[model samples]
Target: MASNAQRRDVTRERILKAAARLLSEEGPSAVTTRRVAHEAGLQPPALYRLFQDKDDLLDATAEHVFAGHLANKLTTAPSDDPVEDLRAGWNLQIGFGLANPYVFGLLLDPARARDTPGQAKGLLILAERVHRIAAAGRLRVSEERAINLIHSAGIGTVHTLLALPPERSDPHLADAAFEAIARAVLTDEPAAPAQDPAAVIASFRSLLPDLPNLTEAEAALLDEWLQR
Candidate 1:
């Protein structure tokens, strides 16, 4: 017989997988513990033992999808140009967003984003990249403004893509729009070099003292996205 820990692990995996499948098939409202258990071939109580509620399962599923997306972006290819790296990262993000629109939709939802740890990690990643750019002294605009603009554009792309009518859901059009936005934010001219994520974040941090108007949840959401 499986030990309690093993059973717990199995249940967790089952719930997450079920949530992801349902999230992809149905929308967010379709994800419930009972539905997940039915999908996983487990009793409803088994799911409750593993996750507190639907929100818990949704969070785990989002993290699982995000980790998969990040794994595809590890690059060994180095360029002396910082803008090139920034372009790579931006394009990668857009590609992932379009590829996993359902999971991406979860991240964009402000209500579901409360109490998420991934939010902070996303900011760290962005800060790391910004720091890299600052070290190269290639920033054409204030780092904070630049980071905010790029970050907002990247996020806005997801919303824009989601808003498109089914008939107009063209991935090629999405990719082209993404490239134009990335070019405008990350480079002063075409063929400019890639920047480091770290330097860009640090420079932005130095300019902003505090998020004055942002509510806790709003601030949390921003940090979560930036960390990623």
Candidate 2:
């Protein structure tokens, strides 16, 4: 005989699979407690015993779906170039959202996203990728800011695509958005140019105020040279 815990696990799995099938075949409206319970070979009240309510079941379903997608993305081999890795991550996210619109909608809801463990995990994955760029000296902005910018752009892009009819959607919108974000947050070229005259002047100017060895008059003269 199966242990009680084992039976419960089997029941939960059945419920989840049933709910996911209904959601995929007939949309969210078809995934009611009654429908899922029937599909899972349980009574409607049994669903409440397993899940707190309909929303709880939905949340679990979304998390399960998103977890699979996140796993696939995480397993992908990262590119040696951090920028290229970021682009790959962006495409993966957009593709997942487009492929699973209902689950994506649930995960992408701003208010719900913070409360969802899967959604938070996804953001952390993106943040780690951004950190690599910062470490490579390719990021123009703070790591936190860059992460937020990329996250916001990705969410917006997915939502925009989801709102349109498939035929009416712009095929290049995702690539265009990513290029704009990359230009905004990444340096023009990799790892800052070697011996860039402007960068040298900027670096010198930053330390001018704190150079005790230089008198104010001398510092002023140095600043003038830096400008030239």
RMSD to native for every prediction? 8.9, 8.5
Instruction: Report the lDDT tens digits of candidate 2 across residue range 129-224.
Output: 887776566776656668899999998999999899978989999999999999888776544446343433444454567789998999999877
Q: What is the C-alpha RMSD, rounded to one decimal, of candidate 1? A: 8.9
The lDDT per prediction is: 0.68, 0.81
lDDT of 1 by residue, 153-203 (tens): 788877787789989886676467656755544444322334545435434
Q: After superposition, how far is residue 32 of candidate 2 from its true place, in Å?
A: 0.6
> Lowest lDDT 10-mer window, candidate 1?
185-194
| CA displacement after TM-score superposition, residue 51 of candidate 1 (Å) | 1.6
TM-score of each: 0.68, 0.79
| Deviation in Å, model 2, residue 85 alpha carbon | 1.4
